[model samples]
Target chain A: MSTAPATTREILIATIADLLDGVRTVAVGASSPIPAAGAMLLRARNEQRGRERVRVIVLGSREHNFFTNGSFELFDATAQGRVDAFFLGGGQIDGQANINLVGTGDYPTSTVRWPGSFGSAYMYYLIPLVILFREEHSPRVLVDKVDFVSAPGSSEGIHRTGGPHALLTSLALFDFDKEKKRFRLRSVHRGHTAEDVRAATGFDYDAPANVPSTPEPDAETMALLRGRVTGELSECYPQFVETLVADRAA
Target chain B: MGEIVSIEALAAQIKDGMTVALGADNSGPAMAATAVLLAQRPKNLHIVCVPISGIQADMLIGAGCVGTLETSAVTLGEAGGAPRFADGIRSGAFKMMDATCPAVLAGLVAGQKGVPFMPIRGVIGSDVLKMRPDWKVIDNPFAPDDPIVVVPAIRPDVALFHAREADRFGNVRIGRQAELAAMAYAAKTTLVTVERIVETSLLADERSAAGVLPALYVGAIAEAKQGAWPIGLAGEYTTDTAEVARYAKMARSADGFAAYIKGFAQRFEAVA
Candidate 1:
């Protein structure tokens, strides 16, 4: 590990890169800077190692996205099983991994409303690796059950090649088991413990007797993240990069 | 035949309670035409966002011009959550038909192809599917036990958008925003606002022809410089982020939203 302490955001990015191993193409949605950074980190690391280049498509970016036919091309490619990995965030996620991007209450007439589902309903089923990401880790977001399933974690008798592969939050990382339709706590981030994760999480999950802290990025990895990845991310997420720099200073 | 009309005249073609489709953020949204529509005070307008939308949808709902909205999502991107859209949905100001991006695009594709419905995978177990009784789950007849969700065709009465340029012959240059072409093809009538009108036909140039939406699909064209103001046209101008951020802040409350709209109307009226 580097002598300089790694920021929580950097650790999360490193964790995301770890999860994205072996992925050929990864698509990050709009307003998702961290995931986009993680994808870029993987691409940068691959370039360093002379490995196969990972195609990272960041939506809403003129430089990152190559889809000429607009969003239709992205959806078509996903339908044809071209997109390998995707990121989905929800207002609420349950023990079963069902996500709620819609709102808190019932159907059309809801007490509170988030942005409606973008493409999760389709992409979650087709993309082979779907990573659930939410920075805020608490019972409010990690609920017992989602009020509305924007996209189910698992479907019965449905042809689904993709579902929630793993969930990464500010506190910890959990891997989803498709057969059990449940999440198992993998590792807690630095400065957080298994007890903290259990206390904050609303849903029950299987946690091993001894959990390990998420590995910190080595000197080389941290150097790549600060240099090349940040530069590429500035095109779409200038403000986010500024904040990341500010966090490092703080 | 397509005719050159004023923005006000183009807005007049959109009657009360008509299903109107608008292009997404990157696909040149007719913000200037939208201003005229808001000024005219059309009612019960069913606004269909090609797949996703931004400030235009927020403004329409804020001004009470829309009775129903069907789209994948309504957001202001970096500006934050669309305050008006969230308020409207909370208060039941209008009916919201929640949909996924692909589903909405698939619906438009079905409408363009003159098909009753299009078979799409996923959304089987989603609450979005549960709310939409119109969407059906059927077994794929060709593949024995394969079940897929089919979305109904979303054929709008009129499609409205802004573009880089168009010819007097009504052919509009949409660039690489193919979803705009999808909306134009699916709608019964297509109205366009352009930055300028070219004397030469768009179809005449082979290089430019691929990106041109033919005059056959376009019902009328109105030349409005900076038609997609506040938003932007690719290679033309960038999004007015400061103005959008200001709108987002002002629109947090009902009174603030009205005041913002009032100022917007006045600003555009002064320009006209």
Candidate 2:
């Protein structure tokens, strides 16, 4: 196994940016900077390339005032629809792509109860391009059945409208199986294999033959990501970027 | 109805056609949604719903508090309930004017700051400007070269919040997100309901005073334990699915909602 450390944020940004190839009108939830930053980078790059730039709506709190600069708030890009895509994160996720942000146990006196499902419960049904990302994939998070389904998957009739389109993780990429109604491995990150991903996930996964590895960041994309990480986003999120830079250097 | 001054009294404040803003979190003070769900206010009562997350928005909209809702996104999870608030937008009953996450925060900030507008970047060539022409993207006409958009302020008429603890004087505290800050700024009148009523001296320490909503801004303070019951608190309970379904059902109809309110009052009476 290649034991080199990987910066989950970098990989996440690169992976999501790849998916942004032709997407427009993405929705982003509040309190998640990584996905929001990734969308911003992709939109910026598209604008420079003279391509039809993507627009993003950071839900709840205004885009700029909450975390980054105020400019991130303006209504500029010019896209149709509320948002076609979204990037999400959570504390615990199940095989069918259901998420649990409420708590680990019961309602009142529980072992762990998070602030209810931030925006997960609603957004999972709306955005056309739903990409749920999680930096940590432990036995606790990757379970056979979520203790609670804070957000529903295709099986719950949520997809009848619009549900999770994708699940991105630190180890691999996954998608919900519409027919059998389960999560299946579509691809693994570079330098990682199917078995490695399964081993990390305590639950059993239906891995397809020839699961492609996530593509490496191209030179142009990497330059942009690196520059932004070393510049704008880094300034706003100094500590997080510092940790990411340290991981890259290490 | 002699004195009519209690937690149950405010139910009368809500008439048939009022626009209300409630306090909501991942948990905490979903009381507004709960109250609405149980009370089953008339459909003629249109609410301009503004929440920090979609869960509350979904609860209220799905329940029907939202005759009109202006929000960014909902659901960060994969399953259950409606996928996105998009279904409402597509159906035509609901209209969604895109607001960037940062802009929403900035709008709330502007509301809190008492500023008319704040200059921001992005959305320069985007639909947000045209769709909501009120959100102007004007050039610094004096400095024609500089490009910026001035986001207008957002101040909701009333803010209703739920907290872990509060004094009768209306001082409140939230453990996780500064949900109260945004509510205080966004709304003109702020109401707080807490799980416990303690001496005002208990909040003397600064460290235990992080998310405190000042008494000055609070119009009323009610002691409602398990106020955020079904909805999970930041470190409290998991969401109560059974209650959500119950509320969702009653929220769908006016009669059903009235019954729910009467029943909820009975339940409150049972415990009271």
TM-scores, all models, native as reference: 0.97, 0.51
Task: For candidate 1, please provide the TM-score of chain A on its own.
Answer: 0.98
Judging by lDDT against the true structure, name the best candidate.
1
lDDT of 2 by residue, A1-250 (tens): 1234435567778778777668867756545557766776787688778998687555433322332211222222212235677766666777777676544654323355344444454455545677888878778878877765655665331113456767788788887676666778888887778878888896676877888887776666666776653465653344456776677777
Q: Tell me the spans in candidate 2 whose CA falls farther than 4 Å from its real position.
A: A1-250, B1-5, B14-19, B36-51, B62-64, B76-91, B94-97, B140-144, B241-272
- lDDT scores of the candidates, listed in order: 0.91, 0.57
B97-134 per-residue lDDT for model 2 (tens digits): 44444455556668888898876544443333444566
Model 1 misses residue A32 by how many Å? 0.8
State candidate 2's TM-score.
0.51
Q: Lowest summed lDDT over 10 consecutive residues: which window, candidate 2 chain A?
A: A69-78
Off by over 4 Å in 1: A1-3, B268-272
> Which candidate has the highest TM-score of all?
1
Model 1: per-residue lDDT, tens digit, B83-154? 999999888999889999999889999999999999998999999999998899999989887899999998
